[model samples]
Target: MELNGVVSAWLLSTVKVKKIKMSKQWGQKAEELEISNKVAGLGLGQKGSNQTSDTEDGPDAANPAEASLLMKIIRQGLVESKLDIEIQRKDPNSPLYSVKTFEALHLKPNLLKGVYAMGFNAPSKIQETALPTLLADPPQNMIAQSQSGTGKTAAFVLAMLSRVDATKNYPQVLCLSPTYELAIQTGEVAAKMAKFCSEIKLKFAVRGEEVPKGTKITDQILIGTPGKMLDWGVKFGMFDLSKIKVFVLDEADVMIDRQGHQEQCIRIHKCLPSTCQMMFFSATYHSAVMEFAEIIVPNPIIIRLLREEESLDNIKQYYVKCKSPEDKYRAICNIYGVITIGQAIIFCHTRKTASWLSEKMSKDGHSVAVLSGELTVDQRIAVLDRFRAGLEKVLITTNVLSRGIDVEQVTLVVNFDMPMDLNKKADCETYLHRIGRTGRFGKAGIAINLIDSPQAMEICLDIEAHFGKKIQLLDIEDAEEIEKIGA
Candidate 1:
């Protein structure tokens, strides 16, 4: 009400007075005021003007910066509040976002053709914001802090792919990931996305796994894990990074978190061309990782999505708090009876628990399979393929399948073992990706977090706090409910 009253006062006053009135009206009634309150409700109430002065003063105001700090806080809170500001569609006559890319940067024909073949209609949010800085005259290095599933891959991929020259192919782009699975996954995407390049053949370097028994490193795009790629680059004497146009540290946070791999990443950076464009992409950013990235790409355009929480509209996330693990297991069985479940991925924290749960489920006569890092590539692939093909109803695994793997048929995700981090547990992105296997391509899906422990309760609390949505819990002790779930 105080807010509405202030807005009302502003609307009645002159533009200059409105600004002063707005500043003075904070923490006062605005919604419940005179008939002029209707003016406050209008869409055209000096958007962004209210905090303009605050932003200009920034952190250099009176009190040796304390006033500026206070102003900054006020502005941030106001912006995030989604109050007083009006949102309307852009005028149709107005131009859309600017076009900035390889063509804008004056790249050659081969690179341009590759970009067209990637099936990109235009730039995504990340691409639109970062391309100008990236494609600058001298090509400033980029430290992109964007969320996953928001097309960060395409931004860097296009930059790297656009740098490759079809004529001379000697591994132009080098991408480093944290794990072998992620490396292979990224390589696959690079291969497919770059398949239309025709001239650029991307290669994957897997340790102890020979590439067709006689594959060479003559590919234009080379993606691999740090250890394997570095080892191969050194062994094959093929790392001539001096001529490399792009160096990408994909998932920089994960890459550097390894015991000593951060130093290795620095070493790899040192090998790159002095003028090469370095790009870093990560879903979450830590201070240490950001500092490390500063060494590789100084003064990077920090592109933030600025979303308060992840979006899980396509994913139905719920929590089932049970008295014990057995009760939680029974709840899952009960829910299965009510819904026709497609391929479901059950997330467990440990291999032992995963295997034990699988065994117990098998005794209950569920067509279940288990997956963990212990599984060989072939074993994992077989399990994944079977699950994808709908041969298996549920497969249990750890975080290995968390980030990159996407199976369309997975309609349900059961968090049998709650995630350790609540911030991550209820994360809409991870939640979407987890339950995304089902309700894919506009299909409806469901995710159930089996909260059978104190730890699981904490995860539930975090989910509630993160999404600001309450989960409906079902009591499954009833015989009818138990029978339905078991059936």
Candidate 2:
């Protein structure tokens, strides 16, 4: 859901503060001070702000350096506390919201078992609100806007599974994704959820999958990309659309925004039975996409779970100041030296840039993987497998890896080239998605924006303003500070 302009304006006015100070010479002692302040900020006042050092004099009173550090710590604490409080205050509670157990949702016994086996204790906010509406007797169409990693997939997957008649396996459900990788991933999730339901057959119609000529698709569930789904449905006549009961458009915003995808999706939708339940899910909802969705999904129960400021609250965003393009490269290397990053993704603006950076970083003794549109499907899959298995430490790529791919161990993201649209203006939504690659499943993550020019810096500021949050500055020259910041 889009943020209300008035609410975002109010949040910016109140919570926007100067960037936090980073001490260049911060050692073990300074680290302790920062931790104490952070604890105090979180309401654990174990040590008072004015406590004295072991020298029988207050640290701030005896040493000017320590004093400056104390003041900065206090300022940082106040800023963080106020931001948290304001976000909590501005979040409006929905009347449809309720806390319920998976059993209470009345899911199929096998699906419920799968849910427990997957370790889901209860329904997420989206699932809580969407499941009942989606699984209602008179099947309803739904257009849901939720943040990444918010269990939107499970919600719809459950709906699809519940609607499918497993006894007769003849393609009762169809799901479409923007990319082949995403389609495969969604298919895997659905398969896992239907583990106990062995009768439910699934088929993927993405690239590289060959369906024999004149072969009827007997799979009860089909998940694939729009282009391939359309090809099989219209050209090959492989699937029976009249019997399909559920149709889902995962990552609906991306599909609608791309050139041919929207048309192909519409064609596939037209072929479906009029009684089919259509469900659309996306992290973003552009005005044009929403208008198109409205036309396609009749009387959809709209569920929006995103607020402007709280979208990126779990991510700690910072920008490294670089003097030149060469300096940006040096900064990248220096970052790896300072922090123990699990798995990081660096975003470049172009495929050329991604390839260049990957090669350079490899030369600099860093194992990096590159993914872009230029890579073939097999190459992309191989790279992703290596990265997911913890074999690769860094991935340098363009916008291809930006949306809908979840890597839990990815704790760091670097925007080597800030996202910009055709007009060269900061594409705020793209930036959000790029950073969102990390910080999955409510984990704390860091996103670093590498700014080497005035234009890049301006773009960073624009993103900051757009999110109503200040981007902290990182000095790459200071190893100690960089370690603390990365930590």
Choose the strongest candidate by TM-score: 2
The best candidate by lDDT is 2
Quality of model 2 by C-alpha lDDT:
0.70
For 1-487, candidate 2 gives per-residue lDDT tens digits of 0110111111111122234445633453364454334433433212122222333111211121122222222222111111111111122452343347888777878888987776677787677778887888778788987645567778899899899887785889999987766776677778788888787778887776766666778888889888878777766677777888999998776565445676677667767888999999876666666667776788777876444446487899999988866888999888888888899999887666766788888998888888765555457667877887888989987655655466789999999888876466787877987898887777888899999888898899999998888899988899998888765
Q: Which consecutive 10 residues in model 2 have the weakest lDDT in total?
A: 1-10
lDDT (Cα, tens digit) per residue for candidate 1, span 1-487: 0000001111111111114366445423332232123322332213221111222112110121121222222222111121121111224352223354446645456555555665555555566666665556566666766544555666677677667777885778888876655665566556545654666767665454343222345677777677666655543445465667778887776565554455456546656667777788875565555656665565455554454333356666667778876777887777776667767788776666677788888898889988665555566667766776778888877644553345667777887766543233444444444554455555666767787777668667876676776665646555564334323
In the order shown, what is each candidate's alpha-carbon RMSD?
Answer: 21.0, 21.6
Overall lDDT per candidate, in order of appearance: 0.57, 0.70
The reply for model 2, stretches above 4 Å from the true place, is 1-99, 107-125, 146-154, 164-244, 257-259, 268-274, 307-323, 331-345, 355-373, 376-394, 403-413, 435-448, 472-487
Question: How do all models score by TM-score?
Answer: 0.59, 0.61
